[model samples]
Target: MVRIREDDINEIRNKAGIVDIISRYLPVYRKGKSYTALCPFHDDHTPSLSISEDKQIYKCFVCGAGGNVFSFVQNYEKITFPEAVVKVASLIDYPLDYEADDVREKIDPHKETLYRILEDTIKYSMYELNNTEAKKQYLEGRGLDERVRQRFEIGYNPPNDALYRFLKAKGYTD
Candidate 1:
């Protein structure tokens, strides 16, 4: 994923209304020029969290927890700062793009072959669970029914260790 730019973060913050964003997490009541709600960060009998409509900032008088909408989400939701920024950015429909690189290297062809072998192992294991006599008892013993095995794509490796020889025959070197 692309990192959000500072300008884009600021623009998203400005576009997203503090009241709308805060209301999603907690209930807010309009009190004259600002909105009030119970402080989420600390225990309190009375509503001490105040949101400034003009400044686009919120403050809790009881806990002294205060910041912009992004900070509030980060604190209340226990999410990362960047996550908060991305959440707010998505709310306001901010455009972000990742830098792409196209480069190829010729090395370790066996790595790709190993990956293919592992994939084939998984596929064969699943087939064994359904069709083979030895695998049927093993699957039942493990409580791995058809549904469970299908869900996880569980399979077994060949007993003869044929995978290595198969890859070698297919022009793969370790």
Candidate 2:
């Protein structure tokens, strides 16, 4: 769970322009000064998606899927309202210092456990890739090409007790 400040939310909202943000999801055409696009939420031959640059709002005339930046992220990504807010904040480079309580209250307890488990698994996998001789052979035997490995930034960790020391320096513990 992570906390988000109200100021961060507002900064995200302001920086995330409606036309630019929505353009990534849908093709928009200029109709006078406003832009119009086919609504992604519904099937429509005529373009009904209208966006106002001044207001930073979008609305689909065919359907009622309309709101500010936060609503757009929430509906499109199918994430929680706070998650959407955080994503937007990150996209806009807004600094956030939220209390854990705020984020914990919003996140599902079951999902939180799963998320933590996945995070730990990734850490373990990365550690094994770097430190284990058998794992390195396995990757090589699997025909893992250098191009692919470089593309993914894969590297073998030296056979030393350095990862634990590194994690400790970073203030992480198992």
Candidate 3:
């Protein structure tokens, strides 16, 4: 599901006038800050689709197809809500920031190369820390238990370029 901020919606609504937008799709005649046009959603000869510049909405007296500009685009273009939103935003040149849902799987079994690389790095660090008694004692002295060290991803490093070598072996650069 895609979600747009209310501020973006309001901005789109304010910038993209319903009178102007409906006029592009169909002929609209203004009468005292409001416009009326033929209801495009239904077969009607009489102009029943009432558009309001003040309310920023449209209402059909006969067919009752009423909503804001987004709904207008949605019904007119025959597109999804997100697609209509994109179209309306494009009309006003509004920027949209997209984000993924917070539902990441625990772990993917068929791990990719990048995932494997990160896992291998963690395992190597764990191995380095596991085999060293001095480093363990130092960490213990610093009030960090095994669980705490593991939680914060604390690693043990030898005197040389172990991490550099690890990355190099994994086909990584810089």
Residues 114-164 of candidate 3: C-alpha lDDT, one tens digit per residue:
687777788788789988989989889999989998887777767799977
Kindly list the per-residue Cα lDDT of model 1 for residues 1-174, writing each as its tens digit: 335577877778878999999998889999999999999999967899999999999999878999999999999889877778877767667774422123235658777777877776676567655667778678778898778878889766567856566657766557
Candidate 1 Cα misplacement greater than 4 A, ranges = 98-174
- On TM-score, the leading prediction is 2
In model 2, pairs of residues that clash are 3-98, 130-157
Error of 1 at 102 (Å): 19
How would the candidate models be sorted by lDDT, starting from the highest? Answer: 3, 1, 2
TM-score of 1: 0.54
Please, what is the whole-model Cα lDDT of each candidate in the order they appear? 0.80, 0.75, 0.83
What's the C-alpha lDDT at position 130 in model 3? 82
TM-score of 3: 0.53
After superposing candidate 3 on the true structure, give the runs of residues whose Cα lies further than 4 Å from its correct spot.
99-174
Candidate 1 Cα RMSD (Å): 7.4
Who is ahead in lDDT, 1 or 3? 3
Cα lDDT of model 2 overall? 0.75
